[model samples]
Target: MLRYLRQIEVIGVENQKKLSNSSVLVIGAGGLGSAVITYLACAGVGKIGVSDGDLVEIHNLDRQFIHAGKIGIKKSKSAEMFIKTLNPEVEIEIYDDFGKDKSLRISKYDLVVCCVDTIEDRHKINEVCFKNKKPMIHAAISGFEGELAVFDFRNSGSPCYECIYPRNIHSEKNSVVSPIAGIVGSMQALEAIKLICNFETLNHLLRMDFRYMEFIKISISKRKDCPVCSKNL
Candidate 1:
């Protein structure tokens, strides 16, 4: 109850207890992933699971704040080390693999935060979450831009990730500026916490342009033909 300084009286004591009992799985440890992981740890989200095959590189320091001075280390391990210091009361889990390998298995978590960079993994997480009937907090970043969306398959008509990206359009690698990932990744953590804490979220997509200092939301509707959500529909 004392761990959540911000939520203490605003959400009351019982809600804080709920937060302490929840588990979340975050699927990246890069720039955006770094932000999501840090806040969730600090927020005292119990039993967090983080996965990333990336090793910290010199270039990641700009926004991957949790791994500063720990370059060349596996991101998941490095993140886990920092999380230990932030809040020991909460248990942390780490993984160094791709998100798609066992999407359904990973979806067993209470909620999923998609901080991984690639669209394929996002699509995969969306599929598994839909199949497993879990909620997904989706986030992505490139250059000075970023986007975030949430699809709680537990709810009817919630849009999946594929409702936003086409298969042909998402085949290539993406370009990312350090802070863009931070901005979007932080939002991912925010959404996940909101869901865990049972607070209202935008529940759609939010796009940000750091260069112009603007943020906007694009309404998303479930696709009846989306291969992932079609069965559930």
Candidate 2:
């Protein structure tokens, strides 16, 4: 409690306890994952699973701070080292290989944070989370813009990632202003904490343009024909 004394004052002791017992799986160790993992570990999430098969590269340092000085190593392993050093009390798990076949692994966590870079990866994660009926926090960054949304599949009526973006859309590597990743990633972590503590979370897609300091919240509904979520419905 001492470690989270200030936070407990805001969320209460019971909520703090909920956080300590919660498990979160972060599916990327890149830019967004770095911030998401850092704050979640700092907030005392009991277990964190990091899944990223990519290796650290020098170009990643501008945003992926967790991999500092660990270039050439596996990102999941680098993330584990960062979490252990930041909060030894938190349990850490690393997955060097993540794909569509890891649905069982997704079922083991209380929440899933989708911080991956590609639209395809997001679809894969969305499918698994929707199938398992788990809450998923998703965020994406490009240039000075980012978007966030929570698909709480625990509720039958909640919208999902594919509900907003169809699977037919493809993603290409985009340039990003580093701070945008931090801004959106931190919000993802906050959403996860709020969900674990039974607080009201964002029920709409939040789009931000940091360059202009603009923020927009758009209402989202389940797509009647969404391939991933509609089938379950």
Give the runs in model 2 whose Cα sits over 4 Å from its true position.
none
In angstroms, how far off is 102's CA in candidate 2?
Answer: 1.4
Distance from true location, Cα of 101 in model 1, Å = 6.0
What would the TM-scores of all predictions be? 0.92, 0.97
Cα RMSDs, all models:
2.0, 1.1
Best by TM-score: 2
Q: Summing lDDT over every window of 10 consecutive residues in candidate 1, give the lowest-scoring window.
A: 99-108
Write the residue-wise lDDT of candidate 1 on 162-182 in tens digits: 877756676544677776777
